[model samples]
Target: MFTRILPAFAAGLLAASPVAADTDIAFALDWRFEGPSAPYFLAIDNGHFEAEGLSVEITAGQGSLDAIPKVASGAFPLGFADINSLVRFLDQNPGAPVTAVMMVYDSPPFSIVGRVSQGISGIGDLEGSVLGAPPPDGAWAQFPILAEVNGIDVSTITIEPVGFPTREPMLAEGNVDAVTGFNFSSYLSLARLGVPEEDITTILFADHGVELYGNAIIVNTDFAAENPEIVTGFLTAVARGWSDAIADPLAAAAAVIERNPAGDQELEGRRLELAIEANVLTDYVRENGMGQIDADRMDRAIEQLRLTYEFTSEPDAALYFTDAYLPDAELRMIAPE
Candidate 1:
């Protein structure tokens, strides 16, 4: 169980009447409707958004970098995306009105998954082996940074650029020794392909050396400034949704299966559990609640990015994220499952 103290103002925000004009919010997700995405759907199914005077419509995204432009272009008022990608996007397209407001994956899922039977087990095992990577994969985009920090000589590895659909299949078929992907997604994909669970080895960049934050709730800065209350209300509802998901992952995945009828309930439930254990409910997040970042860790993450990415402008953490719209502390904490 978890406990929190809520200020009067914060309590008032959460208890705001649903009679207020419902602000239509189109939320763009970073990836397809998988286990991790169930919370947002759970929010809608449970009337959490409606209580906050919000009508949110969620759409699946192609990849980690998919939703940044959508939100910045004003096509979507809000989105979930890789914060690391957002930092680079803002640097390349200066003055683009997009920034992360709530951190979802406190510990990012960027990882290199391998098969033990294929003679690949960890970061160092990739040397002299074929590594399958998708051009737009969030994990692949961060591999250079991971290699630099971990002292893994990327040049020693043969990289085979593969499509998203082919990434897991090629690795499972032993065409590639390993693949860069989310730990939860890739692990489950291999399992469903009939690979023995003991043969799978997940080398999480975060565990080895990567000090980066993962997918975050991004917003159009211009829109957020204009509709501060709406943003706050949206976050409150989201926090509640995530809280529910953490408490009952099976139910959360069931909520997702309701939307995507083809999705396997058991597989998605396991996927959601892995994400919660490895990404979302970290030691820091469990203690401090969610939707905020530690300044020191964020500073280190920025410096780590600078190793591989030459920023056109000086990197400023302020331009990338803000907790201004996060709900109250009580609303943010997800009770231990």
Candidate 2:
């Protein structure tokens, strides 16, 4: 399911070099500080970013799609966002200076999180149920494709457009039967809301027929074109941080707590572990390493998107992502323990 692709026009991919001076990098997170975001904090706490001669300030975002416009408008030089949303954004906006530079979630966390007590456990269970979905949720954006692939009739499902803050609470309060969200985020939220573990059911899109990549480290094409070394160095430090995080996710969560004092350390730690086990440390990542993606898989993802989206022009792989700024393969690999 993976094919190593060497892009002929990748400018900085061949050079394993360092940046000259400290560059101020403003990184925009796709969501609020949580378990999965620990690696970036670990990168900062462990001096990985500093070692790369970068002063990075991380900003929290509203949703997966929130970071797209921030990076495209040059508000943030780098960001974490859903590449599928980026595909749609590019189609609608035409010439946005943003593209995924590194693949973070090799397997997307998109899922329909439901409570078993609410008559939901599998994809088919969603029928005749009210599903709460945030309008901008990345998973909701892909619901059409999920439905098509699974043979679920979306018309039979009642979709209640909910806010991000209310998506889980609505389901937890029995306002809706299920919710579209990231598996880890919604599952943990329901648990925190006093929903029993046995009562929760997370039907991941990947487990079904969806072949989609998840959130990725996106960059402003303008910034990357001007400072390729800075981009490469930043990605190298990110790889180091993720490798360390995979080794000790509890430590990674502790790093996150250091930034957000209000965060529950135990909960975040569990969330981080879940993300590492379920999304980040997939067979592809374990065998091939991080950052770089499978070319064939990406093509399939594009085709999958084509099912729900109408591209303004021919979808060019180069315009969406590149391994140009990724670190060396060895540094990117997260060894299994």
Candidate 3:
């Protein structure tokens, strides 16, 4: 029972006299267009953004950290960012103001994969072993806290910045004992390369002390404040898009392929399959509905950031998001109708 709404501007124009015109929004992605970002592609391909009265111009971001400053300065009104980096930004730049409109992945998928034959049971055994990780500028900053929670000394582990495509081969060839990568893609790629599942050990961040949320839809605080209605409309449409994606993942993947013709169909399929398995909404927003944020989880994440990173001060929860924009009907979508 999917119902489509007309573009927000059209609905508004029809309801009222000819006044000021439509509003435009620019959305920045944390990486080049790919599968994990299918919902956004679906929204665009299916006219969801247009229906919400938004003319969205999507752009690829340098990375999560790079996206934040651009968003804060209004280089882009809205952007996708890693939740951990968002927390750090809030702590450092209190007045800059940003809010997460919706969460993309409820669980962090970053994991350390090691060969089982190496006797790496978990994070504890990684000590004294060479570990390949992305640069500290990326998600590597959180690895220390992950190690701490696992009773491993942060200093005892050597973190070499192994470039993205080289991580798998480096580990396989014994250049590094283990490597950090997305469990979803890396595991499947390893399997495709003939690495047996039984021979691999994965230490997921969610299973450790890194309990922060992952990819999130965020906007500049001023933009959210100045154009609350636009924000609400965008969020409402995004909610519908996520629901549509979850209800029919295969359709969603096809929609993604249609939008990004250059994308790899096999990789996108695998990515979507993994996303479904992760059940991104469970244990967090499932009860409240898609795109809902839990204040408690946010609070815990803030505390963890403070304790682990020695953040100078705590950030106020209200600054990060508002529930006012979420449509009531969309919030009920996760329930049995």
TM for every model, in the order presented, reads 0.93, 0.93, 0.84
Candidate 1 per-residue lDDT over residues 80-199, each given as its tens digit:
999999999999999999999999899999999999999987777888888999988899999999889888878889999998889889988999999999999999998899899899
Candidate 1 regions exceeding 4 Å error are 1-19
Instruction: For residues 216-237, write the lDDT of model 2, one tens digit per residue.
Output: 9999888787778889888988
- Tell me, what's the RMSD of every candidate? 6.8, 6.4, 5.9
Candidate 3 global CA lDDT score: 0.68
RMSD of 2: 6.4
Better by lDDT, candidate 3 or 1? 1
- Model 1 shows how many backbone clashes? 0
Q: For candidate 2, what is the TM-score?
A: 0.93
Q: For candidate 3, lDDT tens digit of each residue in 99-176?
A: 677776677666788877766667778988888886733446667667766778767777788776677777776677
Worst 10 residues of 2 by lDDT: 1-10
Alpha carbon deviation, residue 48, candidate 3 (Å): 1.3
Error of 2 at 246 (Å): 1.1
Angstrom error at residue 170, model 2: 1.2
State model 2's lDDT. Answer: 0.86
Global lDDT of each candidate = 0.87, 0.86, 0.68
